[model samples]
Target chain A: MGKDGEVDFSIIGLENEIEQIQSNIDDLENGKGGSIAIIAEQFAGKTTLINKVCSMNKNRVEMISLSSVVKDEKKLQEIEEQKQIKIIDNCHFLYRHKIGGFDIIERFLKTVTSPENKQYITTWNIHSWNFLENTHEISKYFPVQIKLQGLTQEQARQLILSEYEEGEIQFIEDPTENKEKMINFVIDNTIFLNKEIGIPHLKINYRQIKSKLSRKKIILTPEENIFENIYSISKGNPGISKAIWEQSLVYPQIKPGDIKEPCQDMELDNDESFILSILVSMQNASRSDIIEIAGDEIDIERALQVLSKKNIISSEREHYTIKPEILKCATNFLRRSRLV
Target chain B: MTMVGEESGSLSGMPSIDTGTLLSVISLLIIAYVVTRVISFLLTAFSEKVGKYRIKIKMLLPILKFSIYGYTVYYIMAKLLEVSAQELILFGGLLGAAIGFGLKDLFADLIGGIIIVFEKPYQIGDKIRVGDQYGEVNDIGIRATTITTPDDNYVSIPNYVIFTQSVSSANIGNSEMMVVTDIFLEHGSDMKIARKLLKEAVVTSRFVYMSEKHPITILTKDFPFYIRLRAKAYTRDLRYEFNFESDVSSRAWKELKKKGIKPPGANLIDSSSMPDQRDR
Candidate 1:
């Protein structure tokens, strides 16, 4: 997958979303320009989809990624002057982590609305989108909202299989028994009627011991399809599924058990877990950024080292991110613990 | 009530409590108390280790302690006393009568605790106000609920208070809580500018919960001497409620000052009014 260099920009499960965006662009071309928001979870192909739309209308649309723009009114004004359908990616970056950070979004909204001929196609993280939609009624500014759902089983299978030659990667069923057995007991009572007293007699009787066993089995497809296992683990998120597939590769054969979900069996200290959660929420963070968010009380360097050693987080050019295969797990851990 | 002798052939209905059994029961009670204390301490430590899940982990304490006590009493009654189910039921009824009459308040508190656990009026780590005592609930025991005030004062209110007075919970069971911060500006101040600044202050606060569901709201109330700008926003966590309030207030005041909006003069109102001005 890495050697492919460039990914084919065709969206798999988001064909309907792409069509809606194209229709909106068509409206912009007709001088009936309006705003549309493409919302999805982090790394759910929001940027990819936006790029695809931008490429489809290459000559007519002005594609601007928010990450590339300085968060200033002048930059927004410059973009506003461009007399074309605008595609804005990573609009959530306009939201500041500190107080009064919403000014950029406010200014951007004003600029977008002031121009009757201007139409904006924006992308946002679902969390940030929800926050904006709640605080400022951001959806009201965008007439059209298209949410990108995760890839389907078939779509994930096709995407993952595309990386390998036909029959090159064998899907082997996991031979290990993963089911857990638990014994439980239930108590019951019986009642008898006494004809002489014309009343019902309640007797507490002890029943013979009976074993009630419960077994949990891991279901696998009868046909050798490794993508189903990957989809289940990653919840059909293309990025996460791809990461799991890459991690599970054993050359010619891939076993379902080979893909070890990151941090599943690892124990993390409170500080390490909290730092991990921050990474998951922010996607990628530097040591200083994590220390800033965690305050001086936390030993962020130590926590980073510990997490890195556990392979839950990987350091790249001084920035730390949760391993992609376990992105869902990390997020789930934070949510289950109510840390984010 | 007839007393049944410990001897198998005794005709007395009252169960006999021998000295050995008494000593064993006492030992068991002491053991149960120690175990409960140890478990509570361990669970509390574990809760801290879990970070944001502390409240959920601590919630298990009451259930664990209850089970332990229940089992200990059952052992004393059934195993130690060799009491039948029918006799145990009768003894329970008699004990209930005694408790209802002689220890009514204690029993009421116990029932209140059970209700609090099941009905969940407030939970551990919830920022709640009962009567005038407002703080984060630290522990919900059978007798009383313990709350740690902002000043770190530990106040224990009897659980029965739940039945007599209204209990106000800021966040219910959620970690995020709405914090309403009020900023007063001199009369005739630019209401629009002040409102915008206050809203920005809340949204920008480090402690604020910047989510659509917890949107910041700015409202204006006019009085003779001042215009009250109220900013209602939520803190990301209940623990940050006061921090959120202070952060928004300080930021809003700074921005208001920068915008040349002044607060009402202290001399315009009575000194007594000035003393209670920051009550909210």
Candidate 2:
């Protein structure tokens, strides 16, 4: 009721992009023949930048996303007719095996960006430069190129702060204590900026914070405290962070001010204790390797299945690896738990 | 020829040879050699013919061929020369140590090959991961195992390595394996919404299989600024993981964004959570 829809700001960074994208829009509005492409690595903010341009020119320009329309040329033509600014999001998917030919791309580009159509086009990819050779061959048809790189530290910091605020996430830090630490804390943990909704995305949140603190109360289970302590230490990577948090959260709820000594006070269920042992062993394994090793054991498989379902771990073929932030958080918890 | 005759005479304990005796011996020697060659060829041809019907039998062609030749030579000595079969057999035993030392690895591989045939650690068309290498078993041999990888490269590993090294067989000796994909959402996003979107994504996807074990589920936990949201679903076939993952990820992203759920903040967490050297 209080604008409290989880202050999830999906927009962040791209300050420099906002201006260039606006210019692109202006050029398109004037019926410019040139096309622009934004490219980056996977998860490197390519689509976000292109989307920002489309959003900036929303009313003045019509945009179409051509990612999923692989086998259907008609759908693409239809979208082009409906939209003024044609943007293709998953351009890679179109070229992958039997989907389409370069002729389609060439035809689409020529039709959309022709002077007669008075339209503009933008394409997004993780690596725009990789398309340089191909685009050069197609230059006689469509010839605009733009490459996106990683964010600057300041931009990254701003990006992170925005995501946190948008999420309505509260940091327990007192500003007067050390401003540098606060900024560095957010900057170091933040991977990138959000483009659609502006906000810094933190690596961890309040529920995780609560779970880390509630490892006490289960009188019969003490080992759960290790999981709780580890979750707190992990700082929220989905994989290890949840592993520790879930293990600890299963314990009886405990207040934040309950007491200091986690090792001496906490209790855990047998299953929680068993999970902690594997989690502890998992500290030394990559997510993929863990999946490989644990594939045979029902309990380990169950744990990994749960972990992967939680997005704590990812698998490619026989290999599995925990997400980066989750790894960070889980290890931190382990270190802290060990210290305790 | 004189020296050969002298050696043969000493071995045979004959004093001297007349022209008729020498001619007869030479003809007999020529006949024995010809007979052995013809028999060897016939045996090898039969081995090849048998090999076509059975893989295990095919792998034994070299051994079977050698054994046939060895026994044939012994037969020529015993039957042609009128020498005792026991003497030929004894001579083979005396040469055993020499052959063994020279062919230790070969012998080991051969034995390992036999083990492979009987133990059946892998067979043709089984997906297997051995050490750092993963591929489908193309053919199993007595001394080596041939595998073709997903990249289309064929690798031949020694049968002995298979016996000694750790091997991981996926799909539990079956052709099908569960392929899963993960979907991430912005922190504080409606978990129910995300879950529903993911379930829809999986259910709507052509590749996704709806089974009791593979039911899609969404999980939530704190991940930095965003509550790390994940939707996981399984594919009955492992080969579709690549396509399924891309499809689900893109769909889930579109759904989450359309629902107005932003991604997590970019801010870093407290430095205390940064990995220590010990974490690795």
Candidate 3:
């Protein structure tokens, strides 16, 4: 919201999604469509759509954003019943990845199914949603599951431009234009102590990955090309696209090639991969919470250091989180190892 | 041979190889060697990268190697050396005689290799037991199949052993493998809680892989002195089979002990008081 209490943000491609959610919310009075589970990849803007829906239906919707790992259902139950439709953001925190981790989420899910006059709209991390889908059948609790799709190029452009004033930023084109190669040999410093896994080997970036990942050597580019590259890399992920724009922009001037793909090494060991998956599922975790869940078998310190050094994760004091820019890549890479 | 074509250094009517022809044969041998080595390296590297399809990709190596070697042999006889009908008959006679005599086992191994290639009872990356040697199939070579046992010992069993022995494959060609973990509890321990904890431990394991089609199963059986709580769960990858078992067992036991579930004393694990069953 603005200083005068006007709407500060606009829903771009999310209009239809927001409408579907609102329609589901409207159907709650007649007891139809059940609650909604807004599932999406990291930085795909699940919270934004929830907020937009809440803003539209202010009187009827109540919102609670879980800021950290939720180990108990008391916090959820303590919230006073006010609105017909309750929105819980970051509900992924309801479950930990331990033997008894599903208890809290299980009880919450039961409550979602129990007799009630209201519907609940919850947002969850897609990874956590997948794990729970296998373990707890979490989707059963929320009949209306909206797996949010990424934004289109035009939508991404508008959403990003909405943050800046007209003529405030420069999109400069370079006079020098060089052709790009379909294949490039990039060096990724692999951190393996064995020294025989061939860490320093040349990594061949094929045409597809090359097109998605910008060149290591950034050349000056035009405005539209820059956004195209950003969209290609972010895959229309609004948060990532916006982050790329912000990183690329230098004060008032920006170039097409300024958005550098953070080529992070994801060749992690079993412990490291497990820790990374925990972080991905939980979104963020306190250091002690991570250690406790990881168990004594895993060297949490070594794994965290490796992840931090690889730029795959960031640590602040007692908390660790996956770096947003590399989230998609890390997720895809870990999926190969069945880590996420 | 000396009585037939001794002066010309020929086997009856068969011509002796010239320097150029020998050089071409040597070059072909080099090419075949290099091709197989390069293909093996590429396949192994590609398998590791395409993690989900590692076994599927590895299953191609033996067939590819066989085809390449078969083609090389065919080309050498038909095009390079250009053997005649009579020469082929003579060669066949010599090979038959050799096989009938000292080379019978080698010939049988060759045929066994062929059978293994065409009819794959097991392939590379599969955990299988041939005779008494059981482990993951590390490499399927022409003469032998190599397996790395659970104890980390590399055991090589001849290809012919597959024919003589009963072979069992744990996971045919799938990445997910079932690992059965057993924990022996005292007769009076809480079975319900133990089973629940075991199931939870297996499902929540970092290495666990569960789906609707491939679900985790827990079973209980009564022993004379102890109750065995068994968990049958699938590890995400077969490579982590042992790790999965150890992880689940440790987690389950930790929870079980905390809940005051006791393990069978003296008679089960103790060497001196171990239970014996000789009843038919």
Candidate 4:
């Protein structure tokens, strides 16, 4: 739904770091303030990941998006008076507003931390490596700094293939000549950008490229071995490989599948149907918003948890997007079986 | 001298009897008693018609009874002694002083009773604290007051205590008053989640009134090594204060379990024993 190589359920190489992030969140909640700066770059999934963590807590945590109140002092004071956990998003405005606006927030934090009152949870967004360098003064108060990085190629491939849940991706021998070029393109430009593009997006792009190569009937040398060689160059950068593969899919070598009629007669069980319907209807939503739309239903939470464990749907931010292959499977299941 | 002695002897021989005068004195006393009885009856009837104040009736009955007796004694003594006015006046003065000294405490108590009735430092059915004892005032009398404490102990204290000691009167005449309860949880607990659940637990309780604008607050106090979470709210009735307290605490505990939160296991010290010497 976003970039071509987004990671699915697995965080992959950042396993240790993810554990640290979990603990850091726990520490922040416990009112042990030791960190000063949080540096997250663009498309780094900072907001999404934080939201996911926040959801784990059902009632104890009150996540407030600070971007909504960056301008109004009165409203912010009211929120501070309520004394709940506050998550401030879109903090790029700190640079935009010239930091003076944050003075009120600083005052609130000082009062909250003082002996007279209770400590509160506060989260603010800071982008780029320079966030730590620029906010040297502000960072003195915030003791933790977490840097967000993108997914690796293996992680991306796991995400894409796992989208189908029961099956793995099979790279058949490419009989077409263009497979060499597509594979080479993936190896050269894609894996190098693993930090940017996630894994699932890469496979979707590769799938499209494979379709194009088959249509042209060009002679491709060592077709099945292409993925291995491409992976060698791509390394683990799912984003780049996905991007290159996506571009390769548009070449004349490919033949497009005939569009089937939309499945209108599908009748899925509430949990399955609702999950699939929500996926089909919204197309894309942040992880937070999905939890919210689930409303008061415990079943929805269970469904999401099951789906996440099964790697059918992956989340970024508040939006839970369907993996391209999962979407296709769901579509095929609905069209053929009419079971939503 | 011989003639005077004979005359005195003759007078003494007559036994000092004054028949007509004695007869008139007896008649007068009989008449006076009748008059007193008639007047008392009318007064009693008038009082009954006017008001039903038991103290007023009690006061009037003693005065009337004494007046009737006094009149009879004065008339009989005057006829028998044939004393001078100056002698009677001197005797009356001495008698008054003796009575006054003997009844001084009784008089003070009576005045204190009057003060309580009119001044109304507290009224019946008022929850009050006199000196160190706290209770609801069930009866207020001229000489003493009756109060029922929370433990259902009924105590009778002299009325003068109201004038002498400081009194804490809550809803002195009204029935509605604020009741507060504090709950403490352990440190390292999920304060945010714990607080929310506790607040919901307090406000959602059936005993809690919903009209209040401010919501129930869960205050977190961080001591040297532990955190204390206190839940405070108002209740509808003072009598239900304990019920409200226990209900809120129990509900909060259950909610904590449902939310998968464990409160700090450390024992909580009741803060009531600590007095705030400083101004609040």
Best by lDDT: 3
TM-score, predicted candidate 4 vs. hidden true structure: 0.30
Model 4: per-residue Cα lDDT at residue A85? 50
Model 1 off-target regions past 4 Å?
A: A1-10, A27-33, A74-84, A170-229, A248-257, A264-323, A333-340, B1-15, B27-121, B160-167, B184-193, B210-213, B222-227, B250-271, B274-280
How good is model 2 by TM-score?
A: 0.30
lDDT of 1 by residue, B4-114 (tens): 344553555545766677888899999998999999999988776554567777777777877888799888776777787787688789988999789888988988988
lDDT of all predictions: 0.72, 0.48, 0.81, 0.49
Residue B20's lDDT in candidate 4: 68
The C-alpha RMSD in Å for every predicted model, in order, reads: 12.0, 25.6, 4.4, 34.3
For model 1, residues A1-340, the per-residue Cα lDDT tens digits are 1236655524677778888888888887787847888987766888888887877787777877865223475655555455577777888766554335567888788866876557788988775676576667888888888888889888887777776778777767767563112322322222236232333343221110111221424444522346655665678788888888777787777776575434443456556766876566456666655655565446888889878876788987888877877777676665544445
Report lDDT (Cα) of residue B48, candidate 2: 32
Q: Per-prediction TM-score, please?
A: 0.73, 0.30, 0.90, 0.30
Q: Is the docking of candidate 1 incorrect, acceptable, medium or high quality?
A: incorrect
| Top candidate, metric DockQ | 3
Which residue runs of candidate 2 sit more than 4 Å off their true CA positions?
Answer: A1-340, B1-102, B210-234, B261-280
Per-residue C-alpha lDDT of model 2 across residues B153-225, encoded as one tens digit per residue = 9998887776679876654433334444554446567887776566556544434544444456656556555
Interface RMSD of each: 4.5, 21.4, 1.4, 27.5
Clashing pairs in 3: none
Ten contiguous residues minimizing lDDT sum, candidate 1 chain A: A205-214
lDDT for model 1: 0.72
Query: Cα deviation in Å at residue A130, candidate 2?
Result: 45
